[model samples]
Target: MSGTGFWTPVFDIEKRGDGSILMRQNDPLTDHRPTLADALDHWAETAPDRPFLARRAPGGGDWRRISYGAARAAARAMGASLLTLGLGPDRPLLILSENSLEHALLGLACTCVGIPFAPVSPAYSLVSKDHRKLREIARTLRPGAVNADDPEAFAPALAALAARGRHVISNEDGPGRIGLETLRGGDPAGAEEARAGVGPETIVKYLFTSGSTGAPKAVINTHSMICANQAMVRDCYRFVAERPPVVLDWAPWNHTAGGNKVFYLVMTNGGTFYIDDGRPVSGRFDETLRNLREIACTWYFNVPLGYDLLVEALEGEPALAEMFFRDLGMMFYAGAGMSQITWDRLRAVARRTAGREVLLATGLGATETAPFALACTEVQERAGNVGVPARGLTLKLVPQGGKLEARLKGPTITPGYKGDPAKTAEAFDEEGFYKLGDALRPADPEDFTKGFFFDGRMAENFKLTSGTWVPVGAVRAALVDAMGGLVRDAVIVGENAPELGALLILSEAGAAMAPEAREAALAERLAAAARAATGSASRVRRALVLTEPPSFERGEVTEKGSLNQRQMRGNNAEAIMTLYDGGPGVLTF
Candidate 1:
């Protein structure tokens, strides 16, 4: 499919004398709203009765919606209540809950009243036994107020924060807890006064990075950064401005992809957002499938695994496929590299169902770039091409260890990490570009505008015994794709060894097979992959299947399900040694 009406794909590239390259879009960013409050006010006045947010009703018969005017009123009253409780830029609100109507309202209230808020991942509270990360986050922010939708479910986490003299708010009334209803009854005039103080530079929120390596850093997000990102989004996906986008997304708001990108994408475009109460997991994915059958999203986003599951459903159920692709303008995947099998399946299913090709694309960005820096809008035969930099941003590709390391400077970039001046200083280079720590390879070396492929994470790639650098990201993706359906993900090992090895995480299909059959299947697949590999640096000579999955609490896996390669290797040192030793259960290629 051509990005004829969707994208204005043009770029200006420059090669520097210092062996670096700079790239940016030819056009400039158009004017955008100074603050999110302005967007809420505009939509409320113009489209009073339009549904702005929706969620599954308690019993799940129908969707309960909140209109633009009603949402604005609720936000104003909540903002007034927040101010009365002494919440502001310095002492922000800390939210520990999943995506819900109340969560959305509380976030809007904070933006409206110039009170910076941080919505943390629910896993830190619900999944962890020790709540170590939660305690670290509380210490970092020193928030004055905290909110958890269900006080009973989050009682332990709330107690941990309350011990530090933080105020607790919940939907249910309890001893020493503020009820959500009480916040909704505050005077709107107080909120209106607070809104006047908010400007472009005012802090909107703090989106914490995924603490894959260590404690998560709080990335400061300002009103200008988010608004400029939406402007760039509109310029690239121009069809969104033609009509209000209808999105049903399940990605947690704690991350930038959903928090800043998808959330504001709906709000800034005057679109309707359906908070999906489903996840891309075994038991939870059925809810997502049910929701997709009912809501035809104009713009859809998901991880590669979700697309793999979705393609199976779309191919089997024609009615569900019809509803899904009915008004679908585009499909986007990120967080991991998608397999060519899944990519081809999605395109074929869409063509068979819709009778026309739908744009399937991906991008590359970080939490600091508001997560929309480089987006691919053009048609492609396979996945892995993250297109050029967006408008209003300058991408600097600096030479680093045989790869072009990506660094960016732009209005959409976060100013710095909260309360960590030293770490923040290390984040940017002397030229004032935020170091992304990712390496890129141009798709077409002769034509820079063709876009670039994610080479690998600079920190993850390592040298082999022969001094050849092994790109772990590429090798891992290739291995998983080659394994067909036997493995879900692979952790590449052999940092200083003669060749590469992998610790495999089995897929559902692999786990269901008999022990001997599974081993044979793995050996056959690994041999085939090794034969097809380009060189020793890319080949996997041996493999061992991990009996246990990556633990969230152990920091082996991120909330987005991307494995932390370093953490995984460190946690499984014994397994690596066993694989190299050709021990029992290790498949030798």
Candidate 2:
């Protein structure tokens, strides 16, 4: 096949009974279970009537249900349709869609038929006007089929590839585009009957990183990698080892947390996954709240923003409090650093509802590692320390300056970046371990039993005018913890400037506190707290309360919910300039 294409695994996937597909290979990791296809197939056999895909619509209503049996049928049908197109293991199909029940089914279809599918971010399509990232994605995937579910935006790009041997599938009705309705209606029975053999190492999907450095790189995820990461995280947390887990989350499928961790965790255990259609914006969160009332999740996960909003809803509603507590396994928060004030409320609610506080743990993972690298199982009164490496994973601390950088070696880890050899080289060490780029020495050099505290990224720290290095993550976490929940998050300013200062976002509830009442108010209390916590060169002198939330589409926040420091300064140039000009103690305008 040409000189040498990308690395394709020698192993393959085979369809098991019901909806699952079993892997037919042996490896260093856990004895191979079902392929992604096998995992979903198992759900169909064991729990056919269970609601596998529970989704809330755009408007507020009860959950629209898709059972395990139906999901398996859809995947088989979609897989068959994929085969009828003549695409195989060699050539891949790329899905350009957002997180939806349909997206999940489409992905399963790829797994069933051995076609690699990728769910791209809406930013690279509908939200992104220029399509700069979308253009690069096309160059990277060179897909045989461009699934343009959003043709109002993707039609032009699909048209550009019209002669280049790329097929275009549209949303409803677009000229020269095969509508998804039509594709769905077309006899999936043919494709199901056509299915003969599939593989475990068969690449089921590709997800591109936001790629702040340059062009985003495509992460190649095989069925084995996803299954391994899913199994590892599940075993550590023991979220639902007894029975299948019932989860409610809305994190995008384009990222590892949503795509591999949440999706696979639900599928592997034969759990019911309810996609929270609510976004953290106006009018969207209601749908998420409705789902919470309808079905209590044994496992719950959300970014800090989603949790912050949900806590408010839970506090006000008695029914929600009862639903949240009863049969809830554990509540987990990730995607960004969490604040203590928000952390406290979660526990308070847990205690009131369950008569005992449930564990509110934070973990770490990236799109490259298939998402679950480090996580916390037990409930902690404090924040910031994510537990040790997952089972079957090895960690190393390479000394870099005053800190030791974290790197990992594991079967769950991706082989390398797809289609980019230069990135592949830089991502790994001489021994071929993936360099995590997080500069945090293990708390115990002798034993990782104590676990690792995130020191900061090796590259994130910067020097002041006094030539002192400021560890941003250490300072950021400490400052937030110090202010309690009043000051939610702060962006450490002053790289070669006079002093360290912050541009802070206030808690939604905290921000509502009366500023005139200085003693008990959030702003005044936080200022006092921030003043007391400052070290010699690291203290935040003046904090300008953030009037606006960071925008994802505006590039102020990364896909992982981390603030893009470089982009922040550029986008808020006026705000940064005001800090130097000395307008007010807090900049609201």
Candidate 3:
């Protein structure tokens, strides 16, 4: 446990000696309830007064908390109202805003009545210029109702999808919109009967994929998948169930980690969740800092970008660091691999502030696996170690191409994508394992107990003009880390080209520097990084700074902020051409 009162590492691996390997935790899984509503019911009865969910007031005024009992009462009323609207399995509810108190309650209301709900990325409805993806999603889901926090904000999207024969719900009613208060004022006569009907197989929600490649597919999330996943998380963490968890989260609920994993993690454990308005992006992280100063989280989670910004904040302010570690149990990162430098900085800050090292860890999973399949409970120094599979899950490493492809099979695994049976069939192998399209490499060949590292996404790798394959994940990580704080994230270019290139999104630190200084610093770092590389595949010879952030509407980035390399390259064809054509801003090795 690294003397930090976090998890203790205990991993085991069984090699079949054929071409496959299996890895899992040594501990058994805890008994899980059939549905998420059951967990809510249990906690509502036991810890009625505990704060279950909270969000900042409008304009970030103050925090508003909802007790478990209050939440259940509101959800029952809302669920009954939804039933009156003719919403069922076929006509699901769709939420189009960021996380909020109403969002949580309404999501629970749908699940309580065995009515499915889908939360799509807010960017699709709000940020997209043409509303292309939003229209496509509306056509695909055919939602019976749509909820948004602010009607004025999503007015365009709501009007565009109005012809789908659905009700538009808003906290504040506008023209042709239903008010939230109306739903809360409904009778709870059918709530108990509806709750009783929910079981493990009941479809609770649909979590859409990031759609980094093509059109996003809705991943079916059942009651069993969420409950079993929470069980795996509870068994792995071991300390979460002991006390009420307090989390300050900024990740959007449209994705799995924030939606099912973190939200349910807090709900199942009788925890208090503070929805952070501050994202990890520039000019918004200050909101996160404000929240952290007030709330001492028991468990913390952030992306590598958030941690990079936070490490600096923690280092500069001792009082803030003290407040942060006051009740922190463990620090976790996800959505992408964290750098070893960032990992070291985090541990050092923990040791400095708390007088002992805190457990810094990460895990591996996908939207299809309920997103909590594999976890690293141990304390390690290296980055990208995703540890072993969870207690109730199976990890199969089948040799494919030159890497071991990861496959999963468990109660938490999704049955199939919504409305896509053929695509679902192609997602799994003959043995009924969900083929995760990701590759893994053993950290220690002889001792699998050391865990495994994420090799690269099989679908993301590409061949150079020399016929040599490039592992984009590893190369991107190395390049991003090597550029120091200059690059936030990068999309590897030069697929089928002579040498590798990069389209870099500058970090806040990089953007803050003087123009000339920024370019010089970036160019020097790129040259040094390229000079240190041993092969053409690893070395980046040309680079271009991406001035615009990745467009969610264009599918250049996922809602979780992961880059889609192919999409980025294809979308920025002109930039790549300019780089090779000796453009003015191009940096060369």
Candidate 4:
């Protein structure tokens, strides 16, 4: 299938009399498998030897492949073992590690036999000084078993959790750990019997939200939710059915974007997934570049900053660019907005390398939605048009604070967060639609088919002393863009204040400059941005260079690098006060 043929854009929109809008895809969603295990069974039988998953060798040589048949066999054995260890829906397994073969197999095993497993973010264990979030998750889950790929590396976190009688699984044998081989030594007949009990309503996994706002809530993921989500994905990106998707992804599986969406996308389609060990950061991104040079993904995904770095690499290296665009069906970005600069550069690079423009798209969904509700496949000239609602979803846009608050009702939407009935009650509306807490603006007010742009987060936006509302998401994006690559991100603060101020997180370029030069450059850029703004609500009058990066422990940033504007503002209340007080180091426009 050609890149342009990936999606056929069609939407059905209805404007209600109550100043609300409803939208959905015209095409109805097709039947999907009852469970993801069903898909695994089918693929293992049909494409036994085909590579379903691959990862780089220990020291990074060639890709080590796991065939569908091998995966199914491992799942059965491991599933039986988990059952033997008294793990089930109530006392689930908790994974604490980066993406690895062991992690994938363990997750698959849990899903196959209806044992709900939670892949907690490794940062909570490794990066945090106190492992506070990890302990919190442990308390919430009360997991029967815990798997840490390297027992030695995660020993401190494991100690913090104080796993006394819990089953400890690891890649290598340790003092009190069960090795992967031991898990794979169980009887397959037991797993078969357990699999018979698994159905659509069976809980598959628990994907925890980044606890930026508060303690991470375990979003309940069921077999039905994931299978239906993959069905929606296949319906939209029809090319996946034509040619099984070949994806190389690095997004952590703890988030729904990766664990449910991308992970199941490959499994349902019988596609190959190359687990890229590289990340988008300075030291780790080179591994991604090296992987891209060898593997050409049919469908690609990255955050905006990842694309920014990738475009730079692609522009400078022709071979890398060619390899990247080859066999590429589409590119996707989420978690944050892509700057127009990065968008244009990516399109240009693709056109130059592949002789055509590939589909560069963004979408709006959340952990509760199985993260595949509304996707934009249209070749947008600019960024932030999150297309229309997918089939099997009813998108409700309720007017609130001069913006449309996006809500969704679908099979893909999670039933509720686990172990928190109060939070779940607050999540849905009277009509049972999950409120996204995000506001959207129609790309064209007269035509709903033109798609919707992410206006801002309703929770993030605040009013100034002048009574004008400031859209923090939009303002922060504009400020980062206006800084001309000098600022990576910003926390906008001006709730009930005379004007807006920002705590700017510097980009690599900005950080490398001398203190005086950096201050001057930021001041000039801030002046330019203020002059360009049409109102006090949008203008940022002052800013302070945030020398310290957002801390994961502090809930100032997510694993995907999205800033918690509310948390940051509260964490740096003194700094924000200084900006308003015209203290030293405050750069005024």
Alpha-carbon TM-score of each model against the true structure: 0.99, 0.86, 0.96, 0.98
Candidate 2 residues lying further than 4 Å off, grouped into runs, are 1-29, 57-62, 153-163, 171-174, 185-197, 441-447, 483-488, 506-530, 545-549, 570-574, 581-589
Local distance difference test, each candidate: 0.91, 0.71, 0.87, 0.90
**Residue 69, model 3, lDDT:** 96
Deviation of model 2 at 327, angstroms = 1.1
Tell me, by TM-score, which candidate is best: 1
Task: Give the worst 10-residue stretch by lDDT in candidate 3.
Answer: 1-10
lDDT (10s digit) by residue, model 3, range 279-319:
98779999999999999999999998889889989999999
Model 2, residue 18: C-alpha shift (Å): 53
Candidate 4: Cα lDDT at 213: 66
Clashes of each: 0, 12, 0, 0
Report the CA-based lDDT of candidate 1 relative to the real structure: 0.91
Tens-digit lDDT track of model 1 for 1-589 = 1275566756788999999999987888889998889999999999999999999988676999999999999999999999999888888999999999999999999999999999999998899888888888888999989999888899889877765557898887788889889999999999887899999999989988877777889999999999999998998898888899999999999999999889999999999999988888888899999999999999999998889889999999999999999999999999999989999999999999999999999999988998899988888998899988888999999999889999999999889999899989999999999999999999999987888999999999999999999888999989999998889999999988998999999988899999999888898999999999989999999999998999988989877788989889999999999999989888887
User: Which stretches in model 3 have alpha-carbon errors above 4 Å?
Assistant: 1-18, 25-28
Query: How far does residue 200 in candidate 4 sit from its true spot (Å)?
Result: 0.3
Lowest-sum lDDT 10-residue window in model 4: 1-10
Residue 55 lDDT, candidate 4, scale 0-100:
99
Task: Kindly report which residue stretches of model 1 are placed more than 4 angstroms away from their true locations once superposed.
Answer: none
RMSD to the native, candidate 2?
Answer: 8.8
Ranking by lDDT: 1, 4, 3, 2
Clashing pairs in 4: none
